[model samples]
Target: MEPTTTTPPEPRSRRGRRPHGKVRRRLAGALALGIGLLSVGALYSVVEPAPQTAVAQAADAATIAKGQDLYNNACITCHGANLQGVQDRGPSLVGVGDAAVYFQVSSGRMPLARQEAQAMRKPPTQTFDPHTQEGADNLAALGAFVQANGGGPQLPAATGEALRGDDPARGGELFRLNCASCHNFTGRGGALSSGKFAPSLDPANEDQIYAAMLTGPQNMPKFSDAQLSPQEKKDIIAYIKSVSDGNNDVGGSGLGGIGPTSEGVIAFVVGLAAIVGFAMWLGAKQ
Candidate 1:
C-alpha cells in the first residue's frame, strides 16, 4: 500500500491548530485591537482639544475661561471665587461695572501689593498694550468677564481726543468746583487723610477720567451719572487733557504751579539779600 501512514497526523501541536479557525481568531483580535488603539487616540484628542477651534466656536466662552484663569491667579485671594471679596482685603467686584474694571485694571490700580487706606495708581501689575494682539484680547476678555457678571457702568464704544468738550473754559470751571481739592488746579494730585492721596491726572486718559468719576475708586467719593452729566464729564476730561498735554500756566513759568514753589524762591532771594546787607553794615562798623 502507498505510504499509508503518509502523515503521522503531523505533530500534536500542529494537529491541535485548526488553520482556518486560528487565522480567523487572529484577524478578529487584530481588528479589535486596532479599533481600540484608534479609539484611545481619539479620546486623547478630545481631552486635549485644539485651541483655535474652541475659541472660534465660542468666543465669549473662551473669554470667560481666560478671565477666570487670570482672576484665579491674581484676584482670587482678595476677591472671593465668586467675586464676593475677602474681608479687609478687597471689596466685592460684583456690580462694580466694566467701567470700574477698565479704570482700575487698565490704570494699574488693582492687584495691590498690600492692603492700604486707599489703592494707589501705580504701574499696573498687568499691562495691556493695545498695539499687541494678545494684550488687546486679554484686556477685552477681562472686561467681558466683569460685564457678564453684575452689570453697572460701561466704557464707551468710541475713544478719542475728539470726545472732549468744545470748551476748555467751561471744563475748567467744572474741574475747580468739583476736583480741585483732591487734584490740584493743574490736575497734580494731592495728599489726603491717612496714607491715601489723590493721584495725578497726568497719566489718565479721557475714558479713565470718566470711569473714575463714575466709579469713585478708593477713598474718592462716588460721582454718580446724575451728579455729573456725561457732557460735564467730557468737559472735565477736555480740561484735563488740555492742561496735561501742554502748559496751561498763562503767567510765568508754571514752575509746577504749586503755590509754595514761588513762595520758597522769594524767601530764599530775600534772605540772601538781607544777609549780604547785614554783612556790609558790620564791615562798615569795623
Candidate 2:
C-alpha cells in the first residue's frame, strides 16, 4: 500500500488549514458592526446643528407663536391671517419694525377706526400701551415675531427717557433742521406726498418719538442712531415737551412757552393796562 497509510492522518490544524466556522462568523459580525458604526457616524455629522442656530430657531418659534396669538386677537381683521394685509383695509406688516409697532400701538394709532389717509393718534388700546407692563411685553413679543418673519428695523433697549438728553436748545435746532419739514415746527403732524401724513408728535411719548425717528413710519425717513445721538434725541424730546404742554402742564399759562421773561413782560403789561383802564373809568365817572 505504498506507504499510503492515511498519510499519517493529516494533523487537525494542518488539514487544508481550514478555519473554524465560529471564527468566520465572528469576523463577519465584526465587519458588519464596523460598517454600521461608520454609517452612524456619517449620519450624525450630516444631521448635527450649530448651537447658536438651534437656540435662535427655538426663540423664533416661541416668538412666532406668541405673535400669532396677538395678531389673531387684534390684527387679523385687517392685516390678514398671515399679515399679508387686506385690500383697502390695512397694509402688510412684513418688514415693519418693532419701532413701527411700538410707535403705532403705543400711541393708539393701530386698530384703526376706518381706512383713511393716515392713522390718527388717539388713546392706545388697553393691550398695546407701552407704559403698561403687559403691553410692553406683548409689544416685544410681537415685534420679535414680525422680525423673525420679515426682518425690519429694531428699536433700542434704551427707549423713552433713557434716550433723552439735557440740552433742549440743541434739540430745538436739530428739530428745526430735520424734523420741521414733515412735523411742523410746532410738532403738530403735517401733510405728506401721498394720503399718508405725519402723525402729530403731541400724542407721542418720549419712547414713541424715538421709535418714530428710528423706524420712520409712513413717508418719514429712518434716522439712525449714528445721525442722532442718544443725547440729541433726548434733547429733542425735551424741546418738544417744552413747546408742547410740557410734563407739568398739558396747557400751561405760557403762550407757546415764550420763556419766563416774555410771560412776565406780558403779565406786567396786562396788569398796567388794567390799572390804567380803572383810573380812566373813575375819571370818566367823576
RMSD of 1: 18.3
Number of colliding residue pairs in model 1: 0
Off by over 4 Å in 1: 1-58, 126-131, 259-286
Clashing pairs in 1: none
lDDT of each: 0.79, 0.78
Which candidate has the highest TM-score of all? 1
User: Can you give the TM-score per candidate against the true fold?
Assistant: 0.69, 0.62
Could you tell me which 10 consecutive residues in candidate 2 have the lowest summed lDDT?
A: 248-257
Give residue 260's lDDT in candidate 2 (0 to 100).
34
